[model samples]
Target: HREAHAMQKDWMRQSGIEEEEKAPSIDNFEKIAAERVHLGLLVNELVLSRELKLDDEKVKTKLAEVTNAYPNGDEIRKMYEQNSELMDQLKSTVMEDQVVEWLTERSSFNEKEIEFKELINNNQ
Candidate 1:
């Protein structure tokens, strides 16, 4: 958590986003973190969009798969269709996912196996 907070603060400074007058309290950290992550995704999507064309049908299909995981999937789908804001947000998320997938496909990485305990200890 401390590492995450530090990273968030660093990102805000580098991205020219101003923090509030008060320090971010524990109660608001989750919201702040979510906003930071969302902004990062948007930026990444913008860069990826310039390099690769996105298909609207793929976005819709992914959204459908996600929405169907919920019990009220039909209603949720209707809500997105009826609300432009929600629909746009869904499209943005789907596009980001596509961008990530594309990048992953082209990237190479070395997998290092580590114990769960070691991973937790390292993070701490």
Candidate 2:
């Protein structure tokens, strides 16, 4: 990041664009923040449209996968012991996913399949 900033400074010097001492007073900060929130909501909507779920079985499977990485790893057990609240939150997340999946099956959404490369390029 420092290197990028230094390069930017050099570029500014060459181009004769002075760096401002302070940020501009953008009157529409609230509007910009709202747009970012809306974009996040839209991205979640896209994921929900795919009928994804994170149910109890899914959570267990994920935990098992992680534990498999270290044969004698007690990280999962330690996490469960230390983070009871996190466990409950994970349970709620799983329940919410199940509900969303149920709703998605009944809801109407446009279906379009695009290549992963094309999707990445489009996002960029």
Show the lowest summed lDDT stretch of 10 residues, model 2. 20-29
* Candidate 1 C-alpha lDDT tens digits along 17-59: 6864444554456676677677777767666666666678987
- The residue ranges of model 2 lying beyond 4 angstroms of the native Cα positions read 1-55, 65-73, 111-124
lDDT of 1: 0.74
Best by TM-score: 1
RMSD of 2: 12.6
Candidate 1: stretches off by over 4 Å: 1-27, 34-42, 45-49, 70-72, 113-124
Give every collision pair in model 1: none
TM-score of each: 0.54, 0.35
